[model samples]
Target chain A: MRGGSWRQSSLTGIGVLFGVTLAGLLLLPFFALAISTPASDLLEGATHPLFASALLLSLRTTLTSLSITVVLGTPLAWWLASSSSKTARVIEVLVGLPIVIPPAVVGVALLQTFGREGLLGPALGSVGIALPFTEISVVLAQIVVSAPFFVKAGASAFREVRPDMLIVARTLGASPPVAFFRVALPIALPGLLVGASLAWARALGEFGATLLFAGNMPGRTQTMPLAIFYALESDVRLAIVFSLVLAAVGMLLLVALRFLPALRNFMRGGNA
Target chain B: MTSWQVIVRARRGELDLDVTFEGDEQPIALVGPNGSGKTSVLRAIAGVLDLRDARITVGDTVLEDTSAGVRVPIEERRIGYVPQGFGLFPHLTVLENVEFGLSTGKNPLQSEERSRRALQMLSELNCASLSERSVKHLSGGEKQRIALARSLVLEPAFLLLDEPLAALDATLRRTLRQFLAERLRLFQGPSITVTHDVRDVAALGAQIVALENGRIVQQGPLSLIQQSPATEFLAEFVGAD
Candidate 1:
């Protein structure tokens, strides 16, 4: 069992070669981004007003969208996880539609719902509120595009919590809400954290929806992705810096997701 | 002694459960083959499982009556349940799990009272040393004791235990069976225990309620059931002709 025949070993060697090739090809650009850029160019781009504004806007919008998603999605996830109704199944599919649909399509849908002269045009106008081409629109676009990740992950996580646990909690004199908060939520927190990080990353890189719905306005709705789009046409080095920054944030989230389970186990003094 | 009457009609998956039984202060042992709806009956009495129709009454108080549209919520039912596999809260310390019911019911105790009561319950179970440990770290028997203590701390009017010793090894199961039998003897209120072991019924000296495919085939003392086992499962359980 320790060693295979020569032919079997050669087959495994070939499989390894194929896997390494694909991985190297996928990672080549990141290495290029890190090594090919000049230090002076990176520093200059980092200090630029456009870079700073775009970075700030991306952070602010993604955080806002992430918080909103968690607040709204937790209860929805719990309900969907607990209910065995056909309506819940339908709603689950509808909630997950945004993840599969293109971001540009999502932008169009948001415009149709919130834009002036759209479906809710008169209602919004009566209230003196216009959502299109605003910072709020940027947040809306991010939420529309990113919320599905959180909801999907959260529902699955809540499902993993044993139904018997909730029943016992309720029978132990905790109300339904108390059972969820004390029993289900803590058990599902790790998965929810991963979902939130993914949602934040998706919101941070929102380009199509923000561009079409919020418009690429400097110091307002021009997020890092949009900045990169414009930066690419004028200065490639500036675009590389923006790409590096976005990639770095994404890498950090991936790294966190990788270690989160181990961290949770350590916090729990290792699983029994 | 106050009498408890439980009548439940519910359908879950393939099980069409419609059973009725009444008992005084003595514990009732609910035994059946796999998938015979014993756990569902306990869940129904506890008001955790929604029933098509039910009339659950303990002495003078009605816990559930579908015809009257009076169904007490699970938290207000004053029923303690120990589900199969113990169902301990994985995130809380053992003491915190015990304190949960006392700290957040209809009439919550103050912080000090809650801690004292939880500690007292743990000590009574001989698990005071496990107070600060996470529930995830306890052994199967320890988890069972902590789970029982957690429920008992609420001072429930009724208790429902579902296969409390099913997860333990044979030796541990035997030990906990004796421990549980003693505890049940001391408990003052009506309780139902779901089990497959005939030894459990004989040890607890409980009224027997044998279910088969969601229907109660026998309900009486174990001696009567021993005279004529109703189903093949029960015959195998009691090893009788």
Candidate 2:
């Protein structure tokens, strides 16, 4: 019995060591960044007007992109969840390709689709609509890269919902939209929010695609991440400040996500 | 009075199902072993499954008749279905789960009254105290009651319950079966309950339709079917040991 207890203790010790090491590797950078920066520097960074404007523009674009993603991706996700058709699977794979392809390749693809000399350009021009090198272009770029995240997450979330629940709702006399909003959406909300947050964060920090397609025009197209790039060239302190602001906002969202009721209930359910 | 004559044919994997049944103002229990196409019969009636040749009639209404090419959407069918596994909306509270079927009306009180009626049904089942709890938090027995309340609140012309107690524990199963029988007695309209348990037939005293593989092998009063089971499978299924 003593030997068995010793074996169990040693096994537990090894497991704890492995878990701690993995956590340390993942969290070390953020801790180091925070510890190395003086509180005074962080405070100074927080007060800059340029930082504020970049922050505002980042927020605006991220929100707009997130809205557009939810609007377009939700119905598509629902369809993908409910459909057993081979064609729907093909469409699902096509939507997922954006996430798999490198961001730089996505930039190139977007330019090819919407750039001045590209496909749909002449038609848009005929309608007097220009897409590249503007705030709208920044939103478009973010949507191109980030929308897939929402779609993928939303689809999986919807798929996790049992068809029986939806059937019960319909039998109870709920229309398709009513059943979706009441039953499917609420059940899928936690995942949808997590996906939205991840996509929003990705869009806010997007650099390669924005630089390639939207161009780095300050006050018009330059978001915080782009501003950080330019500020690093001109002033290192300003870049650090921008980075600090971005980190703070990201942390705030992560913290706020915990407060979501659906997530709370989901966690309380313990793997239900 | 509502009446139904349903015939559907569907092939799924190794199972080929061709079933025909007629009922009016009586509860029919489809009792069979696992994978005997009992649930498939219910699904076909609910219009959740497409059949090559299906002819379903509720009263004078022709819900589906593939011979004449008429298929009504599930939403407009006026049939309440409680699928196996409770199928409670995990995100909604018990009251909300029960209220879901009633919330579609233009008058809010129509929904409120329906919800109240649902609560009363839950109370009758001794689950009213769990009204504020999320369906996900409810015990399996509680979820079953909520699923039943949700279905019955619609006041549908035809009710279908597919293995309603299959997900519960053995202890809960026996108790809920009794409660279910009592509830079914109160429902004046036609209902079809599918189950694998022979005890359900004895407890409910329902008209038994015994199925094997994908066909109805024997069907009649529970006493008649119990005493003289037609097939060897039926003899084994009715617990003739």
Candidate 3:
């Protein structure tokens, strides 16, 4: 165990070399982006007429989806964490099923459910509310694909909270609702935030589902990822620039998660 | 009038705790080894966990009744609990923690009155200086005092303390025990304290209830139990110096 030949593991050395090489390979895309494109080119692409509209649409839909996710997912995650009923377990598994399934399959599933000839289509058509290819469909696709990220993360966060603490809060004259809002929510909020951020990022990057279910319509359903794809066919420079911007946004999400109180406490060790 | 009668028959496969007791104005000391169901009894009394067969009455109120389908919720039960090591709310300051009970009460006080009463309780506990300090920053002794102040501020029907001194070292435990004993004596209602230390019973002057293997092997005054042990386990447990 000391500084000796026996302590120097050949297996560990080989494992470390493989890990570094893989890590460097993963970083190659980012390196290529920096190597080929100047920063000013990304600015030029940002000024493109299609870029502004697509970015706007992406921001609007992602924001709406994130709001919807937090509102619905908070209670959903809480119920899942605390409830021991068989139905709750079933619902938890169903909600998590989306995360494991491919986004394109999710696209087809949504299409089969909401398309004009699909499951709820006749009823929805009778009401004259078409979902497919509409902006609302874009938001729906994001929600289907992204809300699970928040719910799963939030449920895990809620589980991390000590049941004893909640019981103690109740003994201190806090009603179940009051204790939930005051004690449990505050304690689990950081995890919830992380979950929300993950959902938002997922919603922003959503591609196959949006393309299949919502369709790429300029100034309506086209998000940043869609914009990048469209630009790739018409203009390669703008495509690369759009990609750089998307990568920056993803990095921004990571930085934002680090600043949250929950993650900060986690990084500093289990003092909380 | 605050006397309570508790009859619990709880069986979780192998773990069984069938206990029956009645007391008024006396601090009941729950004594046993690690797996003796002492914590379970406290949880049952606090109304957080209901036994399979239980009828617990405090004063005139029936907190739990298996046959009658009557079970008061934990908040409405009005029982105070100081958990093992006193898990104080790390988010709130001393005064805020004390005020939390009042803030969430059925009929909460005006903001000024809540703060006034919180500070008053802190003064009584000689911890007014810690009213602004966060619970996370306090030492073990300070946290214990603040926890007591938090529970007492609620004016609960009775206090259920789970190993209050178990987290402290010997010297600190000795000091805090004397403080707790004096404070409990001055309090108006009954209390229950779980402990493994025989000296704790001797110091607190509480009636002893010895539990082993999820059953009450002995229950009486410490002097009585010391003279006549109910079983071999109680003999060694209670009669020890």
Write one digit per residue (lDDT tens) for candidate 1, span A119-212.
9967998999999999999999999899899999999999889999999888888898888888899989988998898899999999998998
lDDT of 3 by residue, A47-66 (tens): 88998898889999999999
Q: How many Å off is the CA of A264 in candidate 1?
A: 3.3
CAPRI tier of model 3: acceptable
User: Could you give the interface RMSD of candidate 1 in angstroms?
Assistant: 1.9
Arrange candidates by DockQ, descending.
1, 2, 3
- Candidate 1, B-chain TM: 0.97
Candidates sorted on lDDT, descending: 1, 3, 2
TM-score of 1: 0.93
| CA lDDT, candidate 2, residue A146 | 91
- TM-score for all models, in order of appearance: 0.93, 0.88, 0.88
Which candidate number would show the highest TM-score if scored against the true structure?
A: 1
Best by lDDT: 1
Writing each residue's lDDT as its tens digit, candidate 2 over B1-241 gives 6778989889867789988888887778998778889888888888888798889999998989997889987877878898888888876778877877677634335766866887887887788888878777678888888888887767787889998998989889989999898888887778899977778877877788887888888889877877899988778778642
Better of 1 and 2 by lDDT: 1
- For every prediction, compared with the true complex, DockQ reads 0.69, 0.52, 0.49
Report how far residue A41 has shifted in candidate 3, in Å.
4.1
